[model samples]
Every structure is written in structure tokens, then in C-alpha cells.
Target: MSLSLEGKHALIAGGSGEMGYHAARALAAAGCNITLMARGSEGLTTAATRLINEVDGDVLTVTADLNNRLSIERAVDHAEESLGPIDILVHAVREDVNGYYDQLDVARLQMAAQTLLIGAANLVAAVVPPMQEAGDGRVMFVIGQDAIRGRPLGLGTCALQHGLLGLMRGLAREVAESGVAVNAVVAGLVDTDRLSVEIDQIVAHTRRDRSAVKSDLANGNAQRRLIQPSEIGATLVWLAQDEAKGLCGQAMVIDGGELG
Candidate 1:
């Protein structure tokens, strides 16, 4: 019943983004040392400072590209060297693609694959082995709801999202006996900076009021509101705990009942 993560270390792959920031916040608050790995040093530093001010643990930032395998390996090594073994690995990446099926080309597809699938594989390869040797670890992916159901004009995005789910499930079974629980947090429309830009675009196209557009989008879900980043953060923290050991190979959907 305990959820204390004291003395643990967590590496958040997309730690500069909204979801990643919140996840790192929650994990750090739960007493986990945090290593935020992302491509941008400025954003990573900003995020690390925010975490340092808000939580109790060493906050380290590593600048690395998710599209490159060697970059991911080196970043993980740096984090482990700084904070010791990573007890939890969170892949909260955001790869934006023009998902129109007709507009999709090999380049776009490769970009998506490299970011979502191949980069994830590289990260797992880098961290999971040491976790297995230590006999305990938590691996989580923060992904979108498109992985479960398709949306119009988002074929490429949905395919990559589902591919991540497939990877999580397959790897969960493979590492079941290794004492490493692998799962994913399937998120819905969250009220983040990214969503604000999207809402602004809708406003510009429709010439509608910003609040009205937000309301209409919120009504897509039964909750009639957008999900908060902190909620997803809480979920990631919970899944990283020992209590969630049995919740492996599953997509913990946090869509405010939107999927229904």
C-alpha cells in the first residue's frame, strides 16, 4: 500500500515538454532523483530549475536527440553516472507529424518511427538491462489516445502511437519475470501549451472566440473539460510505485471518459 519512491532515480525522456515536466514533478515530489533528457538544453535547464525549486532531489538535465540511438545511450549513461541507477524510465515524448494519409511520405514516416519506436527501443536497450540486473524497475510511456482509436486525418500519428503500445505490451511480457513492470499512460486532450496553440489555430480558421472553441473541444469528452497535466503526472507516479506491479502490459487511459 506504500507508494514512497525515496532514494529512487527517474529518467524522463521528454522532460522539457508539459507532460514530461509534470511527470518529473510528481516523481520528484515522491522523492525520486530526476534526470530530464531532451534535445534542447535551454528548455531542459528551465525544467530542471523548476523541479529543483519545487521538489526534493537532485535534478539533472541531459541534452540529447531522441531521433538518434547513440545520443540516447550517452544521455542515459550520463544520468546514471550522476544519480546512480535509474529505477524508473518514463518516455513522455511528443512527435508532431502532418498525419494526413495522403500527405504522408517515407521521410515523415521515418521521422515518426525514429522518434517514437526506434528511439524508444534504444532507450529501453540502454536502461532496462541494468534494471533487470538490479531486479527492479518501472518503464512507462506517455502516449496519446489515438493509439486506441483512429481519428480522421491522423493515420500516421495513430500508427506510430499504436506501435508504441505494441512495443510496451510485447516488452512487458518479455521482461515479466525480470521484475521490471512496463506500461503506458494513454492520454487524451490535455490543456497544455501545445493544445493552446491548436485552439488558437481553430479560432483563426473559424473566427470564433477562443473560449467558445475551447468549450466545444472540451465537450468532445463526457467530462466536458480538458484533462490537467498534473493528473497525468499523478498517474505516472502511481505506476512507478511497487503497488502497481501487477498493472503491467496495459494502457492506463486518462481521457476523462473521452474514448467512451
Candidate 2:
């Protein structure tokens, strides 16, 4: 199916980060007016400027901490005021709390859940009313492979990510007839700047060589290589298009064959 987002407005949370930045760029290129939301204004400004230089469309940056409901609401209001009602919502915000169950503190676990699951729910709630009234919208959560296949080291993150899947499924069923489609993309090890830093930390903690760590991760996937952030971004752009209306309550995994 042809994927086109002409005249669409998209709001991407965590849009200052690696995967989020690429996703925003792809959506903007696909003809969607983009509003990128993040916690810090510095990264948001840089990302927005880069996207504007690359895509011939409207781009706005909003800074909001998802941990606070008031902040999220204010950011959504600012985005709506600047770029009309958001026709597509991409919840890419995630707290990077990588640790074994024993190492994870209660506070960190709660933060992960709040950022990954609760924050996404809040964003959806803010946008869905208008979308339902208009009779059209798309919401997607950018998840991780651990959401499906739990890893011991990813306990907190996995729990939150899987919870997001359930959230999407329930919301999708609730809004299907209203022309709102909710889904998720479960991504694997991607070669993004964020991933690189995460991998470095993992290697240091595990006491493994960088090359060996990379190889071990690659071996889990059929492609035997790290996925590109741009690839994930492209898939999200396709999912946001009108032609993907039939795809709802689905978790599309782009991990090569890792989860298979």
C-alpha cells in the first residue's frame, strides 16, 4: 500500500532522542507537520532545527516532563495551539533504566513504568478526544523487543513495555469504530547513538569486550547486524499513513529474526 501522510499532523514524544529524532524526520518527509516533545529544550531545539533543514514542512518543539501530568497537558496544549489538532501521536518516550531485578530500586522501577506506560496513556488520553470527534487519528507506541521476550536484565523496562502493549490493544479496540488506530512497533537492537551509549554501559557492566557484546546481540537476530534507526522511523511513517488504517492493536516487530 502507498504510504502518504499529506496534510497530517504528528506529535512525537521523546523526539529529541535518537530513534524519536529519526522518526520525526521520516514523518516530516512523508508530508506530516511535526511537533516534537521532550523534557529538555536544548536537544529539542537542535532536533527541530535539523528536521526543518531536511524536510519542507512545519516543525515545532515543545519541552515537557512526562512524569508530571500538568507538564504533559501543557505541552499538548502548546502543540495543539501551534499545529492544529494532532492527527497522529507517536509515543516514543522511554526511561532507560537497564538493570537486573536485584539491582533495580523501587523508585527506578516506578519511574520506568510512569515514563513508558503511564506517560503514553496520558498522551493518548489528551489526543484521543479530539481525534474521536474528528473521526480519525493514529497512535503508535515505539516499544522494544523485550516487551515480547523478557530478558532477565530488562525486568523493569520489559514490564513497562509490555504494559504499553496492553494499553495500545485496549485503546485500539475502544476507538476502532471512531477511525482511530492504535498500534506499536517493537524494535530490537538498533545502531543509534543512544544504543551505542547503552551498549557501552552494558559491556562495562558485563565485563565483556565491545566486539563480543555486539556479536552476541547480533547473533540473536536473523540479520546478524544491528537495525538502523532510520529503518524503524520508516516503518513508523508507513504505519501513520491513512493506508495503514487496517493495522490496529498490532505490535509490529522489526528485529530481523530475533523474536522469531
lDDT string, candidate 2, 98-164, tens digits: 7877888779778778777777777777778899999999898898887898775777777777788
Candidate no. 2 TM-score: 0.94
* Regions of model 2 farther than 4 Å from truth: none
Question: What C-alpha lDDT do the candidate models reach, one value each?
Answer: 0.88, 0.85
Candidate 1 residue-wise lDDT, 134-238, digit = tens: 889999999988889887556777888989999999999999798999999999999899889868766765699999888887998888889999999999989
- The global Cα lDDT (0 to 1) of model 2 is 0.85
Top TM-score model: 2
User: Which residue pairs show backbone clashes in model 2?
Assistant: none
Per-candidate clashes, comma-separated: 0, 0
